[model samples]
Target: MPIIYRIAASIFLLLTTIPFVNGQIFEHPKQQLINADSLRAEYDKAPYFGLYKDNYFIFGTSLNHKPSKENTNVKFQVSIQQKLTKSTLPGGTYLYLYYTQKVFWNVLEESLPMKDLNFNPGIGIAKPLFHKGRYIGKFSFQIEHESNGRDSIQSRSWNKISFGGNILLENNWLIHAKFWIPIVDGENNKDLLKYKGIFQIGTQFMTNDNRWKFGLLLVKRKDWKPNFNIIGEIKYRFSRKADWSIFLQYYNGYGEDLLNYKMFKSQLRAGIVITPPMFSDY
Candidate 1:
């Protein structure tokens, strides 16, 4: 059993067999994972998933290969993002689930006893365009899966797809991008494919009233060779649910044999998010 509880009981029986096999179109009984007036009407109608200011709250923690480390990688996460509709199912939809664990102790030279645990489920499609109500667009897809800990070692079951967007200037800035694809074909380990990627760029900011939020991410991978990655983030929201975030990252790795990946290592993350509030018709 123990293999992270059989991969978390097979992702809890595939999330209870996906609503009995899509019986009611994936059922959405007024979905409310967190309701602050339905997340302020999906953030007045889509503020990048309304800043997740509605639902999705589990927990998070991270500390990965940092400050001259030799394997003491620690990561723990539990996530949920549910909102069957508010718009998007047709072009911009959302349903995300996450479960992660990467624990390795100072045994980083790969003996044959290496360990890994990663489970991910994602569905996100976006096409929002609201100027007055504020919520930019152009996010296409993100499908993920990674189950590694050895089950025959075939790249440990893998898949990923991505396409991205975001553009909102003026009222406090916003810009985002993404591009990733790895439809199956594993084990080339170019420093984990330079954090595996097609490409990514990012930016987002909002302050005070919205409490606070800041972001930046830059990722690159043009088929190995000195690929790059960079990450920076900050977020804060006292009440109105809850939020706390911090992240710093850098990567440029490769060289399992001359492919040579290196950027030392840097990662320090702290996270917490809770939502539920904002419903008024007075």
Candidate 2:
């Protein structure tokens, strides 16, 4: 089997083998959607905003190299989004504005110099997916831009129009996927697509009471190549009542960061993370 399929199968087995307990302790996927909708309605006066993605700070050393300033480093990301519309639009879709920033710091070096900064901002709309009145997941469309802030030969940026969908299973397992078409290519990074694939997919599984979570992501490495950028993550929440958790991630392949998107790399990182109240109940 291909590496991608192997990772996927592993996640499937993990999610299936672990039994979610205390059915009364958590709401169904459909009910969670309803409650989210009701919560939105209650705060119709002001925009609802929260964390847009996993926020974490981690230190890592190359899996392919010995510990060194060039091979060891710290990485962090921050992402947030705000609802733009007070209520659902024509098709029960809600508009939102999003922003995300990723930074690479070579703190292991003498000067503690920074490596790269990726700025991501976008506008998107999302709608709930349902099967026989039961909410399943979400469908989203967005116009986004990402770039590593630099000048001339070193600068990189691109704009894309993307479509994404995910399946929420039993309020414990989630299968998320996205595909995007390049709308505008950066003059300096015309070959960016050679590293950043047009499509990506990931799966996440969480235990009941939201204590432990596992996630795996796969991104194609352009063309018909069998190789893929594989990212795996494991998180352990200190307490069900706290939003902070211990995060560990392993990444292997290209495009781990924008500045060196073309370089093949491998790393194992661990640190702390803060999830969103957006889905705290789950």
Candidate 3:
């Protein structure tokens, strides 16, 4: 095995095992654990920021955590994300922004995209976001723009804009609903433009620390398109400087079946998130 791989494996093992050995395990009262869902309730009642439900604004970087057959650690990116609520209510409108630097192995072989900047920004809104401490409803509109730092005169740019929303029902059972609409002819005046939609339902569960989220995503899209997809993710707080998440998405329609492009694709994505220390609630 390569030396780098060996080192990473050792560190991962140590981080996972050492915590248990040195940390004190909490013994909860029988009544609390036996109840329907006292975990969130206890934390929510805390005086300070306990059960925070605000949207997240994530800014950080990502690398080729998962590689295609021809691309080995072929890409690197720096991205910014913002998730804001339209209101302080349990259910409200919201927005998220994501920007990245993407380098293609076939296009830019040795160097990473961090050196040559590529940007993608999206804006959207979700309504009645999280409601009744259990269910949340949302509708969002999204637009994405991608461009390389190179001169506009040299090469054409890439951009995609989509509008859609999802309605979520949160409870111990975890069943929820989702829908998305892709608006074509919405970008630069290119014909052959079309719109797409999707709907899905699934369930999710919470873990001990109350810091992790995991769920199954079953989805369906327009016919003549790939519909089935499996989704899983773990979001955790690494420290004050960094927050991390690992996500796995497997589906049939990674590409545009309409254009006969990328009809099926599978990818794994992992990213770190950073916040302004001045604003963070240390």
RMSD after CA superposition, every candidate: 18.8, 9.8, 11.1
User: Which residue pairs does candidate 1 place in steric collision?
Assistant: 36-277, 36-278, 37-278, 37-279, 88-92, 253-261, 254-260, 254-261, 255-260, 255-261
Worst lDDT run of 10 residues, candidate 3, spans 273-282
Candidate 2 structure quality by residue, lDDT tens digits, 96-171: 8988778788888987777888989999998866665555667889999999978888888999999988787777
Best by TM-score: 2
lDDT of 3 by residue, 1-282 (tens): 256336534533332332210122222112122432332332233221111111122222222234533332223333333444323324434445544433332233333222233445655543433334432334455666644445533222444545444443332223455454433432321331222234556655544343445556665644665645554544555432233333332223332222222224444434432221111110
Ten residues in a row with the worst lDDT in model 2?
A: 17-26
For candidate 1, the per-residue lDDT at 241 reads 30
Candidate 1 local Cα displacement, residue 49, angstroms: 28
Better of 1 and 3 by TM-score: 3
Q: RMSD, model 1, all Cα superposed? A: 18.8
- Model 2 residue runs over 4 Å out of place are 1-45, 130-135, 278-282
Top lDDT prediction, candidate number: 2
Count of backbone clashes for each model? 10, 0, 6
lDDT of 1 by residue, 1-282 (tens): 258547644543433323221121211112222233433355334322121211111222234443333333333333333434544454335543333333322233354232344444565554545444433333446576654445443334456776767665654566777676766444544345444446778776765355565666666756656455665655566543333323322222321111112323444534343221211000
